[model samples]
Target: MYNGEKRRSSYLMLFIKNRIGTVLIFSVMPLILVSGIILYQFKASHYEKIHAHLGTLVKKHKQNIDSFLNEKLGDIHFIAEIYSFHELGNETFLKEKLETLQQAYGPVFVDLGVVNSHGVQVAYAGPFKLGKAVYSDADWFKEAMKREYVISDVFLGLRGLPHFIVAVRKSVNGDQWVLRATIDFAAFNDLVENIRIGETGFAFILNKEGDFQTKPLMDVIPEKGPYMDLLESDTKEEVQIVEKEDELSGNNIYVSAFLKNGDWLLVYQQKASDAFSAFTKALRVSVIIIILGSIGTIALAFVRFKNMAHHMEKAEHERRLMNEQIIETGKLAVVGELAAGVAHEINNPVAIMVEEAGWIEDLLEEEEFKESENIAEFRRALKQINTQGKRCKEITQKLLSFARKTDSKIQEVQINELIEEIITLSAQRAKFSNVTIGCQLQDGLPVIQGAHTELQQVLLNLINNALDAMEKGGGTIDIKTRLNKDHIVVEIADNGPGIASANLKRIFEPFFTTKPVGKGTGLGLSICYGIMKRLGGDIEVQSVIDKGTIFRINIPLKKYIGEKQDLIM
Candidate 1:
């Protein structure tokens, strides 16, 4: 039994799995798979585009910076080669040169000075009073004496402001003199800071030793951004990209390139999410589409599955109806066989007994019994035997006729006679169950047009139910037939343990029963309800707890149907 149940369950589960599972596998799964594939490819391509664009920007800005530094250095070199020490040593002459350079390049040339090989300012022109400022221990001065010309990192020299200069060394009469020009710090800082892209993108310059050549907008860590690494490396690659995570700013993209002959690194830093924000947005949209598509697919699948299940349920109901029809056909056949069996089994014996009783009567008429003391009693007994035998034959004929009424042929139904016939039919069961069947059928009741077999069935079912109701403790069942306003009415009432109000209203509903498991099928009253409705009649019930119940059926002579019901208090 368990194995059979398991097999049935597995088949049902397999059916269910195929319903929605196959839909999702074929529709939504492929959508998700394709979307994932496309998104992955887009991610790779977008990252490459972002890196390439940032790298190009960093490289181009680095070139501009290199050109700016070289241009300023070139200006100093031209001045040193054109003017001699004695000519440039004059403060008036040095001032005129600074004015000319500044006029040509805006305020980029802050000041001009000629420094000696010993790091002493010989002549200073433009801005700040530093006529004899000594710079023997200064890094720019020391580096300048070694190289032919030098571009310095930002420093707070004599002016105590962040500034750098381009300078060239000249030798005169075995004495070394340097021509130096200060470039505006703000202009150079603008040069790097202007390399902005998104909100968090900015640029700054870092010298070989990890010092800022220009002021960056935000405080930056050279180690975190790997500025120090790029600066210290001897890698000939001019431009390189790296990504790192920072404690304060999350992940950042770093693009670095060599600047000013590898003396400084032009590094651009930006938040990674901000740099690839476009790609992230696209990814979110893709995910949303996949989600919405999945929802739509599942919803459609559910609708389709529900439609299929509904059709299956409807088909099953139809199949059950067909099976019930078959069962009803079998029941009619069995009833017919029962009727035949009763006639064959009981009628012949009854006829034989009647014939034997007559033979005894003939024997009583003989001379031997002429002077019998119980002659009158014997005649009366034989008469009663003959009457009972005929009555038995009448009952057998009634049963046979009732059983043969299996067809649904419409005809004029005599309500009074039909009620009498059903009462007679139920008399035996009523006697057996100790139930008294009584009727107050009115005479000359107007006949109604209906199915005779069905009307008979309705009356028989009601009387039999009354018998069953009073089976346990015998009670009375009263059946009444009357005529009112061209309609014939029949009311069946029983005085057994009464039906509760809750059950009274539902007694006509199919599959509602108060009888024990094997005693009732619960379809009798329901069938009666349907029959009366088609016969242009109404059936109503009234019951009180612990009292009795009345089922009143009304039938009309007109060939129309209406649901008119009235409960008699």
Candidate 2:
């Protein structure tokens, strides 16, 4: 009979927890969540679309640059062949031929030179020395000799001007000779510098190894040397990568490309923020609408529930009691679900703040580094630290806010802050377990209106799972966040012992812990999933055994806070 009573109590608890009536109890909150989710989905979709669009544009631009260079090189090669046949190695003959050719192709072929088999300057048509200059040791000379005809990579030449070489090798009277022409690099730079496809959008180019091949910002000068030795080695013509902070925008950028030059990794890139500016503006407008709508919905819901309860006193009293208990249970479930993640999330900000503080102290002490070239760099580093530290604070605050309540509440929250915290805490955890953590946070994030507690719960669950999957050791967790059109995203990832392919589909099921008996309840993730779904957000996990795992959560920002009284009641 005692066992039977225990079973009955457990069934009742389960029923109360899962009953659809719970939705009614949390109707207004759910409505707000749904509205926020719609906004989030719209925003996410917009970002994907914008990124895709920018990627396509960059690729097309890269192709154009490649085509332009190839066409120009082809023309120069034909001109060089004509000169070779004409015996232009003779100074007098070369001078006369150049004068005639200049008139016909002045814009395209500004200067021509006849180089001997050893790549030494033999005859020149331009104002430069005809016999004194030597090109034997030059990359263009070496490359041309190796190939019948080759376009040299961009480099600063004898004129101290950025140029690329188009050279063709010819066997004249059983002697090898190189016919070469120089094309101004500035010509290509000017072609794409000011062209914009959207607001604040301007395109730039990068070499295959992700270095700026053309003039980037006013301050990003290429290092004094060969271009990282990468341009000449990379055979892939179709790869692109976003530029990290340098002299440009003081932030990272979205870069794309089409492999147009086999010998060059030419790609075009644009600022992602600029490309998605329109969508972000639209998202903000939507947030304002949702804020107003959420208030109205809440008021209507309060009035309806109040009236219905007043008319059905007994049922209302019982329902209210049951709801209070369920809410308490849900709150506990959320806490349990988020235990490991909260540890990691909070630990992150604490760690970063500590590191930044230490750096600040170090900067104050290091007068030499401060006075030298490191000054500007140190200042920038500090700025980034503060920026990132504040972000961490915001995330922790959000988590604390969420953990304090069972119902929804809107507040000004920064998504990057939350993600940063997760990154910090998870990184520490990963470090202890021989796992590394990575973060990719976006800049210039806007404040949002949403339930902080729910978001925190989502973050916590995802992070903790990553920690556990590593079993004994050797794993990595990556946490990142970005602004979609109208929503914010947080992604948690891990490289640990992964879930079996078969178990992957069942991981989210309630009470499905795969651990040994008495180790886990499996309700943690399910409850987290429910909270996110209720909040109009979502949590998804992907993993592979002996490999790793990744979890992504998408949530809407709270645009406004309605009257305090209508919250959770």
Candidate 3:
């Protein structure tokens, strides 16, 4: 049966270990898997969203440029209607009227001209000679002749300068004609060059043929290979692409969106490094917080576990010590009982010897024995025997004190007189060392009900300790008593190398002592603590190493004595 039980316990232990391992793995594995899935999804979704958002930004930018062009062209169209209807068949008059209208629209438009159906420059304004320039072959003029109105892509003009053209066909004097406007492309380039959505986002314009209308503001020329070919093929469709290339730093994804009217693509390209820089910084901080939180959780758990383990070990150690103390206390009880009985039994013999010694001394003093030389020696022996017997009795008395409960005898004791009495009694003892005892007891101290003998014993123990601590070079021991508030305070202080700073607080603990082996039972302060507590008083100590130690015993002056007489009767 014992073997079966052992096998069962072993199986249970193995099962617990397996369970712990399973729990640890299951707890962390799911988090790891979930985090991986979430991070993958987050990365994929973020990239798609960034691409979509970039495309949207470029599309809006293209719309804004288109709208601005249409508005500027509308002003020219209104002027064309005026020239076609009011100034028909008169080029010089039309030119003069167009200049006044152009001046009202401000200086942004450089020149306005009227071109006849034969592509002849009929009317001109703003620093260009009439009949010197014709635009029958210009793309805008050809498109406008077919489609009434069109805007030309940026190209070098007759002045060897880059510019864009707006053309609109109208009926003048019953003949179809084209009205043309020239705008400085450098100003347009400036407007396009500075266009940006965010810190690192850049914008540029491309024409219907996928040719650069304006140079891209980006540091690297946009990838113009397969990706650009695809974009150009789908000029009508707003599309975006993300491509990796060493030409652009970081993860370069160029976004392009087309304007429907001109097939012009407004492209913005962003490096992922700059685009997600803020998010990356935030992610780093979040990871640090999680790591710190996990570390703190583990550290706290470890500290709590260590504390609990220590408490359990401490309690077990105390239990063992308590059992040992109980066993020792039992032995001490037996010893005390034996001592008391032996003291009772030996009292008769001791009394007989003491009486016989008295008689012998009396006889030796008589003249009949005065001449005997050995009589003095006999008397000396008897005296020595009496002294030994008294010493034994004192030892037995102390031993018996441990066998019974100590009760305080309440009496109206004078504070100064008590201190004096204790000093006198202690001075007569051979065990007391050469410690200087002094008293600064206050005069006129109110008499209080307390155990006089027990209080004396408390003082005696403290003085003996001080003397022992002083050893050869005796130090001052001051006993003081005074009335404080509603209490009587008795303070005992010693100038001997004070209690070690570490031990001062535990001085009153039972069986705690600094005395050499066989010199103390270590019960003196413990008994003193119990006696003072029973007397409705408390003992407090303050000490600094190598300075001094002070003990303050406070007793309630107005102790409840029930219906007993106020005076010590």
Indicate which candidate wins on lDDT: 1
Which of the numbered candidates is closest to the native, going by highest TM-score? 1
- lDDT per residue for candidate 1 within 336-412, as digits (tens), equals 45654675589999999999999999999899898999999999999999998997786565444433332366778
Worst 10 residues of 2 by lDDT: 560-569
lDDT of 2 by residue, 1-569 (tens): 34534764565545444542554447646666776788688778987776667667667766677777777667666766666645777778866766765566554555678888776787777766546488889987887778777777667778776777777888779888877776656666776775566544555555555556567533433442223333444435354445455454544454545344444444333455566677667777777876676666656655565555445554654576466545645664555346435734676767778686667857656766656766667676777777767665654544333333345665667777876765676666767777676777778888766667666666776777777777487666777778877667777777777777456555655546788865665656665765565555656665655567777776666443334331222
Candidate 3 lDDT for residue 418: 79
Go through the candidates in order and give each one's C-alpha lDDT.
0.81, 0.63, 0.67
Order of models, best TM-score first: 1, 3, 2
Displacement of the residue 51 alpha carbon in candidate 2, Å: 3.8
State, as a TM-score between 0 and 1, how close model 2 is to the true structure. Answer: 0.44
Clashing pairs in 3: none
lDDT of 3 by residue, 427-530 (tens): 74414466777888888888777778877887888777777777766677888888899888988888877776446545655546788765775667766765
Sort the predicted structures by lDDT, highest score first.
1, 3, 2
